[model samples]
Target: MALSPPLRQHPSGALARRSLLVGTAAWCMGAIAGCTSGAKPPSPVGSSSFTGSRTTAVAASSSPGPELPTAVRWRPGPGEIQPAAKLAAVQLVEALGTWPNGQSGVRAAAGRAAALGIPSALAAQLAGQAGSLLPPADAAVIRVIDAQYGGILSDTASVLVVCDQPTLTGRTVRPGGTTVDVRLSRTSSGWGVTALHPAAPGPARPLDEAAREVFAQSRIELPPASAADIRSGAVHDSVLHAMLQLAGSYRLSVSVVRSGHPLDVFGTDRPSDHPLGRAFDVWRIDGHPVVDPATSRTLITEFMRAAAGAGSYNVGGPVQLTGGATANQFFSDDTHHDHVHIGFTA
Candidate 1:
């Protein structure tokens, strides 16, 4: 099958060979096109930014030689659709009614809370954990609808929830919350909740937390490299600094996990950076801070370029941002969609 424009090539060097593996032709791209959501969508090239994942390593000799550009095809996920405002409004009302504090706030707050659904649950959890002296969230406001997916059989919703707490301390508490995507299914009694597993709540650690997780995995201490040594100083402080900065810019959190067959995204071989304590991955977007569009690309592009530039060090990628031969072969290597692999050699 033909590919979209050829995958961009990293500059010339040992890293260049690594780039070939990053976007190889082995991807059953036709099979997973339907899985677009969050940051991994088939966006139009140019005038838009792209998000992606790591793939299995492809041997340099086995890559299929040049093929023509084929029309890009993306499959629809189960029951995914844009809900009408009325349906959205009704769903919001039903969601709000499902919560425990619906009766404590003004009708407006209740309405807002209902509209956000599971995100409300996350907010409530954060406030309780924070030990807010204020009356628990009486309601939630859909401050932003970060992401939503109408799945093939069930739909999922992702958003940021804002809530109000009435307190005697005369102070307000803000608990950033992320929703674990409620699955919507068609029921005889109309659309009802079929699944809400993997519910994300507040207390989702900050970028600093993600850094600590990465550092914790380190059994031996290597001389600490400044952010510049890691990515030419484009990123500084620690992995936490990179993650927090990335989260703030990307409007998401950087998840760091050492194990769990279900969540191992970088694949079977431990990524180079994971062990050396120089690499990390960005998996989910809940409770993660949002970055403005301008700064959004700052950290991401910097890393991509840095990785491409420091090709001698790590073994992972989507490979190539400009400068030609672009491919997305890394998806085939493992469960890497929605994340990037950054390995450190120091």
Candidate 2:
């Protein structure tokens, strides 16, 4: 397929080959494709980013690859904040979006959600907005790419549900996806979904020179919605520039960019860099999920540092390191254990 943007050059002493495998499940979207990316010329890639039991690693020339599930149901690799809170968000997204044959419509979707113990009113509101079909899809699966913490606090939290939707209509399947900002509150029982904000990117616009380069770079694997954000040309140049520069070295699987993120820092009134298009989240560095205990500490640490070199003012991930122009320039917590956050001041 001929697309905008240009290929990228590999950086000196780049890390080992890495790959990103999409989860199995469908949502409502346009192109149904599994995301496959690699550096120039096919070579040995890293393990599967799937957190499930069966993981199939993929290695091919830098081109779009087939969609494969890391697992049937999504699960956090390791330490995460209020795993139940994130789980509630994921379950709700799946419930409202995914349905078996013969079970279709808002009422049916609401019933599915209510079964998960979601409040009736909340379930109805979410199901109402979940979307509907005319003849209805033979079936739709919710393929959750990655669910990372948007913010975490004592009483409230935000989860960024990044995923793709592959819908089966008749014999043909369509591919598409959207990111959702799921809000939750801490209750006596456990974390529960208080609200859901699916991404509305408006419309696509021509990409800027930098974004075009980014889109063309195979090393930088962007999920559907994130790719759309960049294609819409809303992302800041510094973000795109940093991504292009980073792509030269490490293959990055970006999870979130501007949309489907919290407006303010979780648990605080401070503004979040994401909504401003000055920040992005990386769930996998060089193919190994940051949340995975088996991923190398040295690899993640170096990547975080390199992000700083690429002009990120703030970098957060599972590892904490010292030394920067400002305090807290590099931070770590449960919210970031699952991915690396790279933020630019401009």
Candidate 3:
């Protein structure tokens, strides 16, 4: 029988020391100097300590020493294919997180350009004469997409990216012939951008690299829903995300149920919010609703009122509503009494 490919070893100094110990006492002793200090170390209260050499141990409460860099290995995870695509996604996310929030004018615009997956070199192109290029929301959107997508990408794909841009007025546009070349590669730290090229040729084929990157970053073991399910709308996606975020924060599970009714639709009454996919009904794992009817109504109202304090596309669940019920909530009536309607922007 053939031997299986070896799993990637954790980058550990201990492993290297162990490897050096084979067949030679001197090698063992030399490699394990921490054990040969000639000093008697303390043992557990009930145990004994003696001997020529002893291994030193870190105290339980001690902070771990610096970690070694992980080595690259190409064993695929559940949804992984080629590894390069995954790396591209990681690169984009890392770059986006570098933007500082709260600036204005040219700085803001430059941040937006960077968020749109613009090359670093071209980031300056988006700067406005006054200050920053992007507003807070745009900067935030970029950060969200990067973090969410980066967290989801696969670990094998390789990628490279460029984020430079020169400013023209307050907008930065990718120039036709001056496009930067981005490249990436899979690494132990996940995908890393390896190169950026300018005045280089572009790919002749469609770069599903974007999709591959997104998929790699967010790869999960579950089978994807059907196309129809995906097409249900961004509203569904937004609300579900809010539910997940809320559930995660509380370390709880979310159960969803549809409110059944016609013109009497419980809370807010817009067909799109329910049937067409603007709202969600979240419950606990035990099948109990997240809140009682009276509480839910009050909570929903409060949630919408608080939305102004949150990021865009942030309405959903019991505690994590983004604000503006009439805008975020399409329906409010008796049908939604049991389950809280987690609504999202239209």
Candidate 4:
């Protein structure tokens, strides 16, 4: 039997379904560094002992807030300019967290957001989008994990906001989040976000040259949208690198990367993770079709476990594996019978 197309689900609840689509539908309309230090040497000028790095800290003080992942780079200043700009960007993101209680609430929030540097019209549109996405009964909270300046020119700047949201799904709660790119321009008042867009995944742990070579040589073919997403660097680095690593040994065939609307699980409203750019589907491994009876289940099992080892929180395929990050991490579903789905967290 020919397998059905795999589906993706958004986890932000209803808001996720709508917002993610708004983000993509919006699309339908259409870097890095690091350092090392044998710090036995004075921890480098303004550097704090907490982060244990020479890179200048971006927070207001050395007090340390949330720890940033190794892949994220934070360069606070040559002066107060970058830090100030960063503050403006973050404020707009925070303001966007307000869940409108009703149409009136949306208008109020949009009006307030205008002060943060977003244009009134655009702010209202966003407010309307958010209002539609969120349920009236439950409010959403956004925690800014970290923010970094992507570029800073004389009059404009770009920032990437990494955040987490504790969302209510009926009575049960789950973790959900997304990264956003906010662009700001200098106005009479300071920096303000003029445009907001979903950010592509930044480097988590970059694939080594050898692994990247494997990615280039592998016969894996991704659909146009998925291919564009990968080229755009939207897929998590670890996930891409891990998949490529598998390609080095196996004749891997990929069916989907990121494109199209999210798929609701067969019997649930919860969205799959693919549209988030954190998931991929593999139809064949080592030249053996997953659905072929002659193929050893052992290969599929090993691949699933390897996915977990590669930092995936979810792996679904025709075979069930013994150990995974979560009890239901490995799933068997008719839609996935011919492919293995590997998903990662932000």
- The number of the candidate with the highest TM-score is 2
Tell me the spans in candidate 3 whose CA falls farther than 4 Å from its real position.
Answer: 1-235, 251-269, 285-288, 291-333
Q: List residue ranges in candidate 2 displaced over 4 A.
A: 1-71, 101-104, 129-138
Model 2 lDDT per residue over 170-195, tens place? 55557667788776666565666666
- TM of each candidate vs. truth: 0.30, 0.77, 0.23, 0.39
lDDT string for model 1 (1-346, tens) is 1111111111111101111112213232321122111233222111022222112111121123221111122111211233321133223322332222233333433333323432444324322222211224532211112222211222222211111111111123232222222333343333333222222222323344444543443321111111112222222234444444443333333332111011111112222233234454442233211122223434444544443343323323222345422353122111232234443334
Candidate order by lDDT, decreasing, is 2, 4, 1, 3
Compared with the true structure, all predictions reach lDDT values of 0.27, 0.65, 0.26, 0.48
lDDT of 4 at 64: 30
- If both were scored by lDDT, which would come out higher, candidate 1 or candidate 2? 2
What is the clash count for each candidate, in the order shown? 29, 12, 68, 6
Candidate 4 lands at a TM-score of 0.39
TM-score comparison, 1 vs 4, better candidate: 4
lDDT of 3 at 37: 17
Which sections of candidate 1 miss by over 4 Å?
1-135, 148-173, 185-193, 198-329, 332-346
lDDT of 4 by residue, 39-144 (tens): 2222211122123222422221122322111211222322233565665655555455433122225665566455444556767765554422232423333444
Error of 1 at 87 (Å): 8.8
